[model samples]
Every structure is written in C-alpha cells, then in structure tokens.
Target: MKLGACYVAKDNELKPLREDAYFICNKEQTLDVVDGVGGWAAKGGDVGEYARQLMANVIIAVHEEYMLKRSVDLRRVLHETYFHTKVEGSLTSCILTFKASLLHAVNVRDNGDRPDMAMELVVRVEAGDIVVLGIDGLLDNMYPTKMEEILKRETKGQAGSVCLKKVAQQGMRCTTRLTSLHSLHSLKLQKRQD
Candidate 1:
C-alpha cells in the first residue's frame, strides 16, 4: 500500500495551536490519527501536546507489538495505547490496519460529555482501491463527492496535498470560525492476492 498525508494548522488569533496528530507505519501497514479535544484548552491544558504524546505512545505500542511478533490487533493496540497515554486531555482516535485483503478500522471518542465508546469495521479491499481517512475539520469542510472528484483528478501520492490545499482555500474564503487544524490521509492499495 502507498500512503499520502498532509495537515494544515489554523493561523487564526484565537486558536493557533493544532491539536491533531497522525502516524503511518509502512512496515506494519497501519495508519493512526488522534484529534485532541480542543475544549481542554479552556481548562488550561495543551491539547496539541497531549495529542502529540498520545500519538508518540501509539508508535511505541505498535513497535512493541511488532517486536513481539504478535498479530496487529487494532482494538488491542488502541486500548493499550490509551492506557499508556498519560496526557491530561481527552481525544478521539482512529486506527486502520491492513491485513491480507481486509482493512480493519477502530475508532474511539473520549469527550467529557459522553461515555467513551469504540466502533469497529472491516472491509474487503482490492488493488487500486483508495481509502481516505481524515479528521473532523476536513470532513466538515469538504463533502465526499468533492473529495472523490479531487482524488480522481490527482495521482494517489498527490491526493492528500491537493485535498488539504483545497480545504485551506475554502476555509480562507469563509469565516475564520472553522477549525484551522485539518489532517487527511490517502491510502492507495497496491498489488496483493486475496
């Protein structure tokens, strides 16, 4: 699989910090994203720092699992990472694991208002298939149809950059109320037998 990713940080006066983080492990065929709850900033927390630390812990967890020769279990990895993350803020996390011809997705949200819940999904994938994973900022600004159109026009490697640029342009045209931190990942499935 080939992965492309890009992020745009908000430049506004109110929220200059970007609280989203992403990691791609080519050897493990995994993609992970974490979006820190911006509300934490109101409580004197550094959401960006929490997000970065959470992601760093995730990398460590993945590496430990790889070194142990254990199968990559998306749910287990997320659980372990969350337990190990000693940050002060909450976050929403999504992890994608590619194994054989299947793609496994696990998402968890830990906002203070509601219970911490997780969702899991598995989908069959084929060579040449494109999978897009993004944070809420990008999803709120760009519709799926628009993203499909953009991806169709650009090569796999350039898709993430183009999408981020388009979203940044749109955000610039509109009010600055939109969150400045936008992150996206474009994954192109390469040759693999079923």
Candidate 2:
C-alpha cells in the first residue's frame, strides 16, 4: 500500500504540525494516536507532556490487544481504554486492521476540529469524494467544486504524494511572505491561536 500525508500550520501557532500522523504496514495492524491539548494547555510544556504520556499509554494498551487478535477493532479498544482511564482533556484513537481486504479508519475529537484528507487524481479514489474526520482547517479553502478540480488535475499514484507535498511547500512559503494573506486564508481562525 502507498502512504500519503500532509499538514499545515500558521506562524506563531500553538502547535507546529498538529500532533498527528499515520503509517501503513505490511501486516493488517496499524494505529495512529493523537494528543489534542487544546488552547493554552497545549502550548504549556507540562500539559503538552502529560498529553503525550496519555497517548503513549493508549498505544501500549492497544498494541497489547492487537498482538492477541490481528482482527481486533483498534478504534473501539482505544475508545474504551481512554474512557476507562479517564484522562482529562485527552482523546485516544486507533485505526486497526479488521480483515486482509478491508481498511478501517476511526477518529474521536475532544474540542478542536477534525483532521482533513484529500484524495486527488488517484486511480484508487473518485473525484468529488472527500473524507474529513475531526479537522476543519483544510475545508475552508476546499469545497466540493474545488476538490473536484484538484482531483481531476492531479496525476494518479505518485502524483497524490506530489500534490500533497506541494501543499506543504506552498504553506511553507506563506511563512516567508511579509503579508499574512496565504497563511491567514488557508488556516482556520480556530486553528490559529496566535
């Protein structure tokens, strides 16, 4: 399987890269955890650290169960574990393999917007089809029509990664501009705590 990912952040923002990620493996076992320490606490050193530790706990616990049954629904396991742990201001998440052919994605959000993912010009995905979880920053500039244009213009396969990387590069350029036009327009007001 091919892996594709992207993230954008404005200058003086609370979080640099949004504290989230995903990876594809040879086996049908994969999990992604995130620490959404909202507002000031996310910027605070101690609280940010606490959130990371909480995520680690969730991962370890889920990983143990995953080892037992490769078919376990990791997302549900993580949700149950987090609820049982009762860690304040922290949300646990997991994306596990259910079967050899099926791929499942699960997400839980506490206070912030869910993450956004775009599938463009890929033979695997269709046009005008967007899957957005709890993040909202990418949706402001991306609409149904706009997404269709992107999906149509992009090349299939490796082109998806290239397109996503271009987005990252374009966002990086925003940081260098004297005016905050690009950064301000692309990033959501809620995401920009600066």
Candidate 3:
C-alpha cells in the first residue's frame, strides 16, 4: 500500500511555469521533484528548458530502474542527467521512495556526506508524519524554524494541504521570484492498512 498523502503544484504567482517539474510514479512507489537553478538566467540560458529535459530523462531513468526491479537512486539519476543533459545551469532534486516501513529520500546537492553503512536520508516513518521537499528558492525564503511552526499550527485536522499551499504562497509572496520558478511539494506519510 502507498504510505503517504501528497500534493505538488506551482504556486499561482506572476511568473510562467518552466523550471519546476514533479512526477509521481505510483507503480514505482516513488515521487520526484526537480528545481532548476537560474544562475545563467541572465546569460540567455533557459532554466525551463533544461529542467524539462532533465525531468523527462529522470522519468525514463526511473522507469528503467523499475523494470530492472531496483530501487531509485538519486545519485545515479543526477549523473545520468548531467552526462546526457546539456543544461546551462544546475538543478536540485529530491527523490522519495516508499517501501513498507521505510521512506528513503535521495537528495542531490553540491556536497553532502555519502551514505555509509546506514542510509543517508532513510527514515522509519509511520502514519501522520509530514515530509516536505522543495528547492533552495523556497527554503531561502522560509527557514526550517518558521516551517515547523506553520506545520504545527496548520495540521490540526485535514489541513495539511491547506497548510502547504499557504506556506508556498507566502514564501513566493516574500521572494522576488515568481511562483512558476518556485516549486513546493509536500506529503504526509501514512500507511494504507485497508
């Protein structure tokens, strides 16, 4: 059974949608969100185009891995995207895989410690645990401390979706970037026992 309730969207801001891409493969029990960085936005580099191409490649990769009966690997996806994709700028992605009692998160960043004997971002999640993933654009605008408070306040009932939308909208409101350039995805990990 799937172990989460999730929502993904580009906030309704003034910007056009391009650089942010998200896909959920229910057969693979995985979800992926990718955000393109616009360091070359001023240099005629197309963040949106790169993000799209990369996302498509990621979907293919995920499908291939699934066919081979393998787990999702963020690092492999990153490498494949990098070598095959000709993007002017870089992007960050978070891949979440749910299998039974484990929720494995694979985040590709510039630098991070490798998963040693243990998984790098593995969590033994139960029902009612909320997991939010986004790019630096969103986090830069809203810190983790503020996020915790908002999540706590908004999740009193079936308000997880509402809370996430509010957070994404408010984050975009304070930032100079448009909502299209910003992506926010959230899910509450709960098992389906029925």
Candidate 4:
C-alpha cells in the first residue's frame, strides 16, 4: 500500500482556523479524518479543538489495539475513540482500514447527540486501485470528473498534493458561492502488489 496526504486551511479572514484533522497509521493500514462542526463556534466553542483531540485519541487507540494484537475492527475503534474523546464540540468522522484486499469503512456524523452506531461498508479492492478520502471542503467544491482527471494525470506519490492544489484552486474560484472554502484535507491511497 502507498499513501499520500495534503491539507490546506481556509483562506478567509473571518474564520481563520482550520477545523479538520486526519490520522494515518501505516503499521496497521488505517486512516481517519475528522471534521469539526463549525456551528459550534457560534456557541463559543473552539471548533478545531474537538477534532484535534478526537484524532489524537484515535491514534492512541489504534496503537493500543495493535500492541494488544487485536484485529482491526473499525466499529470498535470508532466507539472506543468517540467515548474517549471528551472535547466540547461535535464532529463528523470517517475511519478506514485496509486488509487482505478489502477496505473497511465506518462513518459517523454527530448531530449533537451521542453517536450510537456508524454507517459501515466493506469493499474489495485490487492492485493499482486508488482510494481517495477528503472532507466536505474538497468534495463539495470539486466535481467527480474534475477530481478523476487530476488524479489520472499524477503518479501515486503525487496524487495527494496535485489533487489538493487543484481542489483548492477550484474552491478559490468559487468563493462567491454561499459556502466559502472550509479547511481542505485529502488522502490518496493506492494499492500496490507485494
């Protein structure tokens, strides 16, 4: 497996903080992205703090699980990490694990309530397949065809940076839209044959 990642903060004066966080555990072939709920800022919360803490706890939980020789159960990991994260804001989380040519994904959107269950999915992948993960900043701004075109022009190692740059440019051009660019983060993973 080969992975590349990139992050860009929102280029706005009013909201200078970037509220997205990501984690990559190469040893366990796991990746996580958390987006802090910007609405919390209206309630006097530090929008980015909760996401940062949640990602930090996810790293700890993943390492602990690996050290204990436990299987990569994304649901358990999410549940463990969510409860352990005692921060003041809400967030949306996406966790992914790659094993034996299969990708396991768990996604949760916190609606100011305790997250009881997450949406889960498993998909089989093949060598040379590419998996892209990003927060809404990137997804909402760029079209699928545009993203595919950019990725198709880059090598595996360059995909992350190139995609981020292209997406950020697109977001800048669309600044007149209702939703200005939020923090943008992207992870590009390519399956390689051993």
* Highest TM-score model number: 4
Q: For residues 89-177, what per-residue lDDT tens digits would candidate 1 score against the true structure?
A: 76666778889998887655342222124566788999988887876667656666666777777755776567667775685567344
At residue 20, what lDDT does model 2 achieve? 41
**Model 2: how far residue 13 lies from native, Å:** 9.6
Q: TM-scores, in order shown?
A: 0.79, 0.50, 0.66, 0.82
Clashes of each: 0, 6, 0, 0
Residues 1-194 of candidate 3: C-alpha lDDT, one tens digit per residue: 33233334566575467577777788877777766665647877777777777677778888888888887775565456555565555556666777787877654433342222112367787877766665544555566666677877776554754666567667776774423322223211111111
lDDT of 4 by residue, 52-147 (tens): 877888898889889999867877777677677676776666788898899888755443333344666788889987777776766766665666
TM for candidate 2 is: 0.50
Where does candidate 2 stray beyond 4 Å?
9-26, 29-37, 40-51, 80-87, 90-101, 107-134, 155-158, 165-194
How accurate locally, in lDDT, is each candidate?
Answer: 0.68, 0.41, 0.59, 0.69
Candidate 1 residue runs with Cα over 4 Å from true position: 12-17, 111-117, 175-194
Q: What's every prediction's RMSD, in angstroms? A: 8.2, 9.2, 9.1, 7.8
Model 3 scores what on Cα lDDT? 0.59
Candidate with top lDDT is 4
